[model samples]
Target: TRRHRCRTSASQCSFCEEYILWFSIAQDILKYISPRDEIKLPELELPNINELKQQQLKQQQQLLQQQQQQTLLQSARSSSKPKFTIEMSSGGDNQSTSSSLSLNNEEEVPANMNTIAPVPAAAVAAASTTPELKVENNPDAGIWITSQGVFYFKLNTLHIHLQFFYSVLKELDRIIDIDALYYLLCCLKLLILNDECLETAAKDNRGFLSYCLEKLLVPHIWKIFALGHGHLNECCVPLLLHALNYEPGKTALWNILERDFSSAHWKVRSSAGTRVIALYSLLKPKLIKNNYNVLSVLAYAFLNLITSIEDVEPTVSQKAMCSLETLGDASFKTVMCALEFQFDTVINDRSIILHRLSKLYTILLRNNSTIKILSWEFFLNRFDTLSIESQISMEESGELISPQSIGGFNTESEHFIRKLNQIRFAMAKTDSIKPISSSIRVPSHQRRTTTTVPRQTNVTSDKVETDSIGSFLSPETENSDRSTLQLLVNLLMKFMMKDDQNQVNDDRIMLKQQVTSNI
Candidate 1:
């Protein structure tokens, strides 16, 4: 009772003078962006000696550059500013240090000058040679060249190393110890695909992209397929799909597609699913028809594989939904026509259909440009077709579609209705064309925008787009805007009037049991 009264004043309490929270929080923040995650940088093979050497060399170079720049300004301020000078020194065990001034002044600096400073011999060698490749307003090329320069020079200089964009991929494949390869590939493909240097390199060297594809992606396709462990970078297939559409025949996209479609690995299989969307979307614009037979096989494979997983991880489920929604483009509608006849036979499982429904609902719930309305979007927007197909299953006495306790049909139907309206409203706003009839979708895929997926493209079907390539536009895509409006009145009425006398009977039985127990 007297403990509080006897307690010392607030500042007098025994407390350790520690800032663990701040330190721990700082550690966590660093963990979020730990440099170890980057694929471009090689592992630190050197000890503190290597690091110190680098630091010393950096300091020396800085000093030399300052002297040279100081010389340049002095000369510019004076009569003579011709000699551009840099410095280098020897490191541990005769390791030479080179100082490079990246932003040196424009005046021609000579290689030799005592008043300036001694050029690190290696620095002098590089200065005596050609300048590094310069990319003009192109990041991809710069990335590619920086990457290439390191490998080309065989200098093994880690700090001032090349960007090594393409070849870094090959190194990653060799070095990554585990399934990290997939994630690494994902990071790198995303990096390289969007890199300004790689793009510039591709533009500057017309054949460089193909060379990279052949070296980095093409050779590994078979190994990726052969491993069949279902481990693949989610970005890998889509990036390839991007390449396929980017220049069409510039790279061997068809090969990657064929391989992924046939791959036994579920991860690879799922990638194939999205790639199918990419293929159709890509072909839709050009009216280029890929092999329907292979496409058909992929469809069955995708559905069967999708349905087979009794308990799917959330990421897989989410990605599968995305892949499906992306399939919704007008091109997919064209493809689905051929697929509709087979739906009853191919997709009869009630549980799978429900699962598909749940996933479709999720995708539509999150729809935007990034989730490029692939065939799945086509299927969801055309839920009427799905319901018709479901009715066939019910009639066949093959277990009616049941949502696995995720939500009730009424809620789902309403969600579906709301999403459909969004699609319609979005179309109305985008097309500036009101529907002649409430049910009609707008002229489809006319004037489709050409921006690829973006950050926060969490929209279910993230958009897929191509750049700096031949433009292929679609006509049928415009038809999709017409698949408008909200809940189907008849369907809602059916749900409202659904027979549920079994529930009453069950309740009566429960009441009787309760009375008997009380007696």
Candidate 2:
């Protein structure tokens, strides 16, 4: 009949046939990918639910029959007991008579009574009690596979079963494919964004929230970087930003951005800069409030932004500048203070300091309001102080250091000074205060001595020249100069030494010629 129905509705049955084929393929694939230990055995048979039910019913019936037989036996034993007994004269005679009477009664009982013994208490209880059957309904019980081949759970159900969500996180960690991991991240982001209940659930389960924020999302940022680029801002950044809805997530994000901003990798720094901008934009409403806690967070963020403005990477620098611009009036003092601190601290790389100074000068030039707020006099004093220190060091060293040299004369410093002079001159024209001299003044005693030593031998002269050149050059030059000086010194000493044997021979020849002339 079923075959006839299928034949009559072939078009309707085609969909079912196709679905069966697809399901079979999926099962085969699952079997192929599954571990060897999990492989199924064809010879093993699974018990049917109906068979199990029937078996249970038969066992219960057997228990009921046994219980009924025990009850009948117990009643028969109670009724068959002797109602009255006859006694003899003496004690021994009475005992013998009673025993004979019990024996006679036992022999009179039916032979089937031998099989009707008392059942154990545990068996009786088992026979009396019935097994309870419970049915459980779980709507979100299975793994859901999407069209993209990503497996996930329903967002609405994730909050209900947190362990399943954690398992998803674990699976996400195991995924090596970038696209698959990214799809999973997108699903998580959707779960966070769409499920309003998750927030309350996360609040209730702080461990779950912390695990997702710190363990799952934060680590994935670096993992994504390690795997590939171009997806961080799209996949991880928005997810982290959205996660900032929770207080713990906000803290985690702050730590992440802070650590990444100073990362050794430029890519991490650039991404961090971009994240900071997004974070500020997202928190701007709360940041603008007069709350101290929020304001403190803003201060730390602004400090990181200011520090990034001098980043060697142009991407990071531009992002920092854009973030600062977005911050506008709120970050004015923080930026100024941070720049001041950076300028005061002498870093080994003068170029970085110069870069930061140049960026700040550009900002002041672009924004007139910034110029009004900054004290150009203080900067002039600081610049002059640094210039004097550099001059003293240069004069003491007695070598003309190149402006481009690290930890040496910084041309950017002079350029920044000129810009500061222009700003000072422009500002001084309005006020009566005289423009301070931007030129660095070296004390007469601190000046480098230029006295020349008298020229010695060629080797000595060469040694002096090499020494002077090597002093200003890098360490490699110093090594080469030392080697050359040793060679020249050894050659000069060899040339200056006399050959006593040859001198003695020439003296003897002179004496022989004189004696011959005399003869």
Candidate 3:
């Protein structure tokens, strides 16, 4: 029953006895370290894999060759023997005589078939190898990660699982070996990364894993920061993000992210800003409720982190802007609030801030058309007078409003207006295309021109012509005339589309008629 047979100076024994011998030695060492009968930690060491591999390979080859040699010997013996049969009577005496004769024929061989050679014990003990892991608790049952099935743990009801979380945190603190900590992280990652394991854990109504995630993970986030330094442990990001998904942990997440956003290093700030945007993708109205607007915190951070659109470090500004784009409708409210309270002083001095703010507003409008409509109504109806008053104030104080400020504002406003018009025209074109499928038809004259009267009959006097030409030239009427021309152009485009469709249909009918006549 020996897994590894090894000969000692006094006697031959199995590897199991040697293991027991070494295990007792380990226990003695633990006893020496023990203080006043305290429980000792058992640290197991692993054996060298190369030695085991060589020993196993040699054993396999020997087994195969031995099997082959035995097969050849059996063939030789059968070939040497004759294939003759000896008839025997049913009586016991005749049967015994026949059996004795067969045995007498086998006795003619020189060797005894019942004997086996003794195997020499191997020096290497392959069976004694064990995994290299330390356990502070029971040695018989090793450490394992088991999920308590729960999506989240309520703070009041966490008494059932809180102790487990505390125990893990305490053990983690005691572990000074970086390798052990790394293994611990890998084990937890298996818990979160495995979809099947996660589902099973959740279904089993075990909340220990969820409690560790919700309560223990964030407070211990600083440990990762210390170990990883400036670079974040990529393994922890998924868990951190997952924690943020739960409603209870968002506050803690916001605090940690805010701290990083304000770090002395720009790289950390950049990373935090990137996460802000990522978290924004998961933001919902429900998630943003209860006086916790992740978007607003994110918006404030976006503005706080970057000096201007043209920061000394362009990447920082770019990251902030990228995070800003996911702010949804919150962008509109933030911008309006800024314009009312913060803009007048800051806007005149830093043109880059104005430019970035306008870019964010444009993104918001492009995504939500209803916001655009609301914005127009709000600005035109509410802010018109305020804007006029501000303009007057600027005119009065030339020293405050520099040429650079005016130019930047005009440039940013122009870019936003261009984007707005492009979106509007695209919507118009799509609407026109959809309506083209309608069956309604109009007379050619009516479709070609909205005016019913003939040009000659409706001829205007010289004064009327002069007035019309002068009105087109007047600066006061320029906006109105431009809008009027746009309307007319749109109408003309629709009429052209109808004409093209009618001509195509008529050509198809004529071609069919000609084919029928020829037949």
Candidates' RMSD to native: 25.7, 36.0, 32.4
TM-score for candidate 2, residues paired by index: 0.30
lDDT of 3 by residue, 44-157 (tens): 111223444576789899999999998898788768755433433445676757776886667565553321221111211221242342212221232112122112233334
lDDT digits (tens) for residues 3-97 of candidate 1: 22215545432321122233345334533543443223111111233345577789899999999998887776556532333223333323321
Better model by lDDT, 1 or 3?
3
Clashes of each: 53, 0, 3
lDDT measured at residue 360 in model 2 versus the true structure, 0 to 100: 48
Off by over 4 Å in 1: 1-163, 179-183, 186-190, 218-232, 248-251, 259-519
Candidate 3 wrong stretches, greater than 4 Å = 1-158, 165-216, 219-258, 293-298, 302-310, 321-356, 362-374, 377-519
Q: Give the TM-score of candidate 1.
A: 0.25
Full ranking by lDDT = 2, 3, 1
* Candidates 2 and 3, the one with greater lDDT: 2
Task: Evaluate model 2: give its lDDT.
Answer: 0.44
Residue clash pairs of candidate 3: 148-206, 148-207, 149-206
Candidate 2: stretches off by over 4 Å:
1-160, 176-178, 221-238, 262-271, 274-299, 311-519
Q: Model 2, range 54-98, lDDT digits (tens) per residue?
A: 777898999999999988987887788554443433457777677
- Candidate 2: how many backbone clashes? 0
**How well does candidate 3 score on lDDT at residue 75?**
81
- Which one is best on lDDT? 2
Go through the candidates in order and give each one's C-alpha lDDT: 0.37, 0.44, 0.39
How big is the positional error of residue 429 in model 2, measured in Å on the Cα after superposition?
Answer: 43
